[model samples]
Structures are given as structure tokens and as C-alpha cells.
Target: MKNLTDMMKQARELQSKLAAAQEELEKLEIEGSSGGGLVRVTLTGKGAMTAVKIDPSLFNPDEAEILEDLITAAHNDAKTKAETVVGEKMKSLTGGLPLPPGLNLG
Candidate 1:
């Protein structure tokens, strides 16, 4: 039927768009910071951490726990940002329709 043929064509186009978006995400970088900007994290759009920055003043042997906590916070921030970016990108590609909850793109 013509309708089935059209549906198949649309599916192929959507698949192409998703593949292109995935490639773009691999090349995109998102940054997030915390601890009054004393810590920063950079991650790829695919949620891989690429770099971490910590304020020199935070380096104290007696207070290493604080530094660890800050690093964790920064990483989480970066991850959340990456998810938001991916979600926005997917939304655009899907004509504003959000993917199902808990759907893992990776």
C-alpha cells in the first residue's frame, strides 16, 4: 500500500537523522562547574569525561575529602548537562517528540 511504503521511507529518513546526530554528539563538548566555580568538568556529548579542573587553593592534604566531593559534584553537573543537550538534540530531530522515559541512547 502507498501508506506502508511512505511509512518505510520515513523510517529510513529518521534513522539517517539519528545516525548523523550521534556523530555530531561525539564531536560536541559540554562544560559544567560547581563549588563556586572552583571546580569544572568537561564532557563529550556522549557523557565521556574529557577533563577536570580544580582550584589550586583546594589542594590540602588535610582536606582532600572536600576536593573529592567537589570533583564528584562537577562531574555530575557535566553529565546532567550532557543529557540535556542530547535530549534537546533528540527532540529537535523528532519534531519535538521526546523519546520514551529511561530509553538509553548509548
Candidate 2:
């Protein structure tokens, strides 16, 4: 019974830590750029895009498709960075323990 009680206490502590970590992750801003910095995207640690910036030099209507591609690339870069940050945070919170399959904090 004592061991069970101790385990329960540890579980609650872990839950509290996880909650705090998630809150921190939600406040993170990650930036990624591509095409020689002609395109840039910012994403939250939860992988939601917050902003995008494009160089004015790529404003030609004829190059709209190219601009779109650069934007996509920049978004992908930002998403990858956001995922990385979430992963590192989760890893530290879990003390490097592997999370269950299909379970992701990001």
C-alpha cells in the first residue's frame, strides 16, 4: 500500500510537470526561412502558423507560382522547427523516456 501511494504521488507530480511544459510550449515562437531568406514563416510550438513574410522582389504576378512554392517551403521549415522544439521539451520533461506510440505533445 505504501508503494502504491508513492507511485500515485509521483504520477500527480509528473502530470503537473507535463501541464507546465505544455503551457511553455504553447508560448514558444519559432521562425524558419527559405529561398535565401526571401520567404519566412513563424509558427507556434504547437505547429500553428502565426505569420509569414515574403520579399517584395518576388511580387511579380508572373512568378506567383514560384512565390507560392517558396511560401510552402518556408512554412514546412517552420513546422519542422516547431516540432523539434516540442520534441526536445517533451524529452526533457520525460527524462528521455520514449512516449507511447501515436502519442505526441506537438
Candidate 3:
């Protein structure tokens, strides 16, 4: 019974820490650039895009497709960075414990 009680306490503490971590993750901003810095994207740690910037020289109508591709690349880069941040935070919070399959904090 004592062991069970202690386990429950630990579980609650972990839960609290995870919640706090999630909140912190939401507040984190990550930036990624592509096309030799001609395009950039910013994303929250939760992977939501917050902003995008593109070089004005890419605004030619004929190069719209290229611009679109660059934007996509930048967004992908930002998303990857955001995922990395969340993953590192979760790993620290869990003390390197592996999360269950299909479970992700990001």
C-alpha cells in the first residue's frame, strides 16, 4: 500500500510537470530558413506556424511556383525544429523513459 501510494504521488508530480512543459512549449518560438535564407518560417513548439518571410526578389509572377516551394521548405524546416524542441523537453521530463507508442507531446 505504501508503495502504491508513493507511485501515485510520483504519477501526479509527473503529470504536473508535463502540463507545465506543454505550456512552456506553446510559448516557445522556433525559426527555420530555406533557399539560402531567402525564405523563413516561424513556428510554435506545438508545430503551428506563426509567421513567414520571403525575399521580395522572389515575387515575380513567373517564379510563383518556386516561391511556393521555398515557402513549403521553410515551413517544413520550422516544423522539424519545433518537434525537436518538444521531444527534448519531453525526454527530460520523463527522465529518458520511452513514451507509449502513438503517444506524442508535440
Q: Which ten residues in a row have the lowest lDDT in candidate 2?
A: 97-106
Which residue pairs collide in model 1, if any?
Answer: none
Tens-place lDDT digits, model 1, residues 72-102: 9999999999999998888888898767889
Backbone clash numbers for all candidates listed: 0, 0, 0
Model 2, TM vs. native: 0.94
Q: Could you say which candidate leads in lDDT?
A: 3
Q: Candidate 2: which stretches are off by over 4 Å?
A: none
Candidate 2, residues 1-106: lDDT per residue as tens digits? 9999999999899889999988887889999898999999998888888899999999999999999999999999998988888888889888898989998667
**Candidate 1 Cα errors over 4 Å, as ranges:** 98-102
Candidate 3 — worst ten consecutive residues by lDDT sum?
79-88
TM for every model, in the order presented, reads: 0.90, 0.94, 0.96
User: Quick one: best TM-score, which candidate?
Assistant: 3
Candidate 3 structure quality by residue, lDDT tens digits, 12-95: 999999999989988999999999999999998998888999999999999999999999999998889888888889999999
Against the hidden true structure, what lDDT does model 3 obtain? 0.92
Candidates' lDDT values, in order?
Answer: 0.90, 0.90, 0.92
